[model samples]
Target: MTFSDVVEAVKSLSTDEKIEIQLLLQQYLREERREEIYQNFRAAQAELENGSLKFSSNIDELRKLIQE
Candidate 1:
C-alpha cells in the first residue's frame, strides 16, 4: 500500500491502540539501537585489551585532530 493509505489506516485506530503501537515501536527501536551501541563498545574494549588501540600524548596533535 501507499504511504497515504497506511497513514489513513493508522488514523482509524482508537487513541489507546495508537498510543500502544507507538510505544511498542519506540521501545523496539530503542532496544535495537542500544544493542548496536553495546556491541560497538565491546569491540572497542577488546581492541584496547589486545593492545591494538593507540593514543596521542601530544596535546597539539590531539587538538588538531579534534578540529578536523
Candidate 2:
C-alpha cells in the first residue's frame, strides 16, 4: 500500500496500538541514525588512512581550513 493508505490505517489503530507503533518507529529511527554514524566513522577512517583527512589544532586553524 501507499503512504497515504498507511497513514489512514495507522489513524484507525487503537490508542495502545498507536503508542506501540510510535515506540517502534522511534526505535527504528534511532537504529537508522546509529547506522549512519557508523558509516560516517568508517568513511572518516578511510580518509585518514589515505592521508586525506585534515585536522585542526585550534579555532584559528579550523577557520583557515574552512576558508580554503
Candidate 3:
C-alpha cells in the first residue's frame, strides 16, 4: 500500500489505538536511531585501528581537517 493508504487507515483507527500506534512508532524510531549510532561507532573504531582516522584536540584542528 502507498503512504496515502496508510494515512487513511491510521485516520480510521480509534483514539486509543492511534495513541498505541504512535507509541509503537516512537519506540521503533528510537531503536533504529540507536542501531545507526552503534554502526557508526563500529565504523569509526575500525578506521582508527587502520590508522585512517585522525583525532583533533580543538575546533580549529577539526575545521582544518574538514577543509582538507
14-63: candidate 3 lDDT, tens digit per residue: 99999999999999999999999999999999999999899889999999
Backbone clash pairs for candidate 2 read none
lDDT of 2: 0.97
Off by over 4 Å in 2: 58-60
Q: How does candidate 3 fare on TM-score? A: 0.90
- Report lDDT (CA) for all predictions: 0.92, 0.97, 0.98
The local distance difference test score of model 3 is 0.98
Worst 10 residues of 2 by lDDT: 56-65
Order the candidates by TM-score, highest first. 3, 2, 1
What TM-score do all the candidates reach, one by one? 0.64, 0.86, 0.90
What would the per-residue lDDT of candidate 2 be over residues 1-68, giving only the tens digit for each residue?
Answer: 99999999999999999999999999999999999999999999999999988997899999988898
User: What's model 2's lDDT at 52?
Assistant: 87
